[model samples]
Target chain A: MSSTPTALPDPMTLREVYQQQQPYTRMTPLLVSESLSKLIHGDVLVKAESLQKTGAFKFRGAIYRLLLLTPEQKQQGVTAYSSGNFARGLAAAGKILNVKVTLVMPADAPENKIASAKKLGANVVLCQQMEPSREEAAQKLSEDIANQNGSILLHPFDDPEIIKGQSAVGVELMQQLQQQQINCQSLLCPVGGGSLVAGCSLLFDPFHTSTQVFGVEPEGYAGMNQSLLVNHLSRAPGKNLSHCDALLARSPGKANFEVVRQTSVKGLRVSEHFVVEAVQIAFEELKLVLEPSGAIALGALMQYPAQFRGQTVVAIATGGNVDKALFTELVNK
Target chain B: MSSTPTALPDPMTLREVYQQQQPYTRMTPLLVSESLSKLIHGDVLVKAESLQKTGAFKFRGAIYRLLLLTPEQKQQGVTAYSSGNFARGLAAAGKILNVKVTLVMPADAPENKIASAKKLGANVVLCQQMEPSREEAAQKLSEDIANQNGSILLHPFDDPEIIKGQSAVGVELMQQLQQQQINCQSLLCPVGGGSLVAGCSLLFDPFHTSTQVFGVEPEGYAGMNQSLLVNHLSRAPGKNLSHCDALLARSPGKANFEVVRQTSVKGLRVSEHFVVEAVQIAFEELKLVLEPSGAIALGALMQYPAQFRGQTVVAIATGGNVDKALFTELVNK
Candidate 1:
């Protein structure tokens, strides 16, 4: 893989994108966690993107991606593959923008995710092949559908436009921190294919800011962490099972990895046990319903509290689209 | 009971209280519900107080009540009786203000609520008496304790200052609605002892604004609803079981009822089944964790969609202090 990367979006462009999406996107509350703050002996803030439209930060990217579509592309529509969050976001965005959206999801994806996507007026095709991984199989199916229908193909997280769109989360977080007069020392974001972290990292001036950004991933799917360690793109071994269905991507997207590599983003992996505990903590303490993937950043904090101890920290709770049964089982555990 | 009431606080006073408490309180997000809007053929916005500090709007009133205490009262501390939400809120408020708090709670209150109050540094006493109603029994026990210790007795919902503090919710809602240019026709608040409804009602001018304020209650615990209909205070029959633990108060507090009665606030009630469904809907659609009592207002909208059809509406989701077992049970159902 090439080590060199394309230029990232400047802060001005990021702000412009954010301003354009401001009316459509929700300004999710930046909540201070008393319990976590006490535990870590520092201020712990949660940027609850789980409360965003379509129950995830993906909606920002999805909406922006659709808005940037060429007139012809918008008319023809778009297709994409996602385990859940992005599919729902894109489906809703498509509905809002009057663009046709087709989603290819794994056959075994959470029932609620599939149902929500369909309910949002997406044409959903379930891919049953799990031999080469559900994500890859679904991506292949989506590409085939796009080719057949002459629709533009959308990558759930790897695209530059999508990453630019995801930067709105970072833009909003910076604004909130400024408003609250908070100077956070550390920032944590959950990484699936790394679009959220990649986009967010673009906002902080690594040369001047003391803030250290971390891309947190589940243990089995620590591809981003591995790639960051090796200083090159790498795939996760994918040997272990995890409940974070949304963070099961085997590798970071090329565009996302490129952006992250150009920034000062460190990668951290959290155990499955801690991810479940994070979900429960979010429910009990933060009063937020976070999926395992969304809670992964907080899970990293719990897993490595000493590293962030006595330092103001911000954790992005990226999504809350977990299946009811899984959420119940995890919280109960 | 006498219908004549004490003078209500004006809008300026309400805004003053809100400003004083603004720095301490969370400006919880006002979320638009596409599903609910489609169901009623109107714009439905949810004021998610479930995301408030101590996981309920009770924190607003609790903090304000403690702030208003004299130096002697602060030094001597205070005592109150509540099923759960107010206990947790008061305990948290006391912790923040460095005031000692003692709470008398019904023995059967949810385990999480009791645990949270204790965790917040409150001295908790469980009242086992059920003959005169759990709320009355607890109130008596708290009064006895207050008298013995010379600590001031605080009414959980009946106090005028507390109502003024809770008016912050309405104040914030109006600001958010104004910012969004939304002119909602109806406002619904979950009614327990009715402080929230009364406080919010004071903000909307009955003689000017066309918006109708509603105090929504569980079917069996419709004390506030019944009182509003009869133009005086009344007690609920309290013969049926309900999951709305926070809203089991047999009658409205005198101050709350008086304030509500002076306004044009109507009453609405929803069944146990719909309250459970509202919790599920809040979880699925709004990505919010709402306790049964917190969800009753949304339940009212679900129960009476015809009445709110084609009109913009706002429902205050008051709290998210439910136990894990019950929340799991309700959402799963």
Candidate 2:
């Protein structure tokens, strides 16, 4: 899947992506919070990707995906579907590379995210879909837009190169751990299309055998968790009004599911109720601003600390694009 | 003043402090926010010390101060007085070093900061001083406590060791800018007792003449500005009620003013109204949680961008120990 006319796919370790990303990426800090440690009764190393370029880990994948495009593909530009973080990440990446990019976001997506993407110079189209989920509707519109405009189709989290690009986070995390001389017992990442978790799982795979990776999802939209349980791409009932707008995918991406299925992905489902508290904890204790979806992995740890007791765990705080009004309300409450 | 520091503080470059802090410090990212750049039509690099240990750059100084303590001093313990960030930093540092730390804080200081310091296992004394200023009263109490306990009295900011330690922020910034091949035109830091700005000025001295260091203060408490203008430690009229509790020092430290005076520190005074907006900017655009004092340096840039127009400016976001209630009010309104 990593094979390109110019580069081989499988041998293309995240190390190469890491090298390519050096020019654009901020080495997000791995921080240990005393308050968080006290809460969980163990050490919790927070990988603050909330401070990543475009304010999310999605940018790592977005930039890498754009970088790997064939010259012919770059000439035509790229189109993708994202609710928020990916949209902003791709828009920023496209602007950086001087590539024409189009994004399909749900009409109901956070206004701040939509506005930020437009400001970043992306052609943004809002898809009006609510039957299964806005994400599916956005996906359909993005596919049509790509076909009509003759642009290369970019899956927000499905394609192998994108997953490979996303895996750069895991690679960087591993290197940081090694440098600190600390061995992690488990790594928690919030999963949407399962790309981040699947990619992380690959890096901490059986060969590394040192740390277990767990994907976290909101209870209703636990697509990756459901899929893993069923050993197939399963659809989740995405009917709940979750503040985690970024993780509203009704089903895991096909390619993402394939990778997770092979990798034996373990996932824990978290309810929406704990999200605001998690966000609050980030702002108050961790001095980080995280969107609801971005705070889910921390939410997982906070809601179920006993499971990780006595083990050093790292929770990936993935994004920080919450709208001012909503963020005000969430944190205030 | 740089002598013996009990330990040769003049030779105690920030590089050495940086090395000492490797075990506890997070190399806070120097982020270029594209959104922030477009807002002011200038390049602004954010040194996110909001993510530093104890959620502030004060931790850098606190830890370094604690680390350099003589064995006798360590055995006797230490005492310092701070309204907020320094209290937390010193408390956390003391916890790590197994020293009994005592902190004297204003009775009216932010509840969150008080709670956090207590949580870090410090002996907290709330000073009942609303006249002259909470700071002076706290200092008087701290002196009494030191005498009574026979512990080493630590100056929160005036001590050369603490100032030398805080200079590590400047050193890190220079390294980050060098790595990105960025030649910063001006570096901005929020000033209280002036330790941070004083330390920063030493490194970006006549040697690295390209970058000018500017210390920012809230309008009513621009003591460093007044002090620099007079070539001595001058007290400002501290009458305003502002949210920047962490930066409420009515006068810059005598030693700190001496260093900044020699270094020719440039100063900018920002109104309290603009500080809330800067806090909002950090929350929304930068994905960082910054206390009013921490965001004041960025506030200076935002309130007066014309001065930094068409040039690259690096603003130090010093801390993020803001109360949720205050944060909600600042961001919401």
Top of the candidates by DockQ = 1
Error of 1 at B260 (Å): 1.2
| Alpha-carbon DockQ of candidate 2 | 0.81
Model 1 residue pairs with clashes: none
TM-scores for every predicted model? 0.98, 0.94
- Candidate 2 residue B107 Cα shift, in angstroms, is 1.2
lDDT of 2 at A82: 94
TM-score (C-alpha, index-matched) for candidate 1 = 0.98
User: How accurate locally is residue A177 in candidate 1, as Cα lDDT from 0 to 100?
Assistant: 90
- Tell how far residue B177 is off in model 1, in angstroms: 1.1
- Give the lDDT of residue A5 in candidate 2: 24
lDDT against the true structure, per candidate, is 0.91, 0.86
Q: For residue A239, give model 2's deviation from the true position in Å.
A: 2.5
RMSD of each: 1.2, 3.2
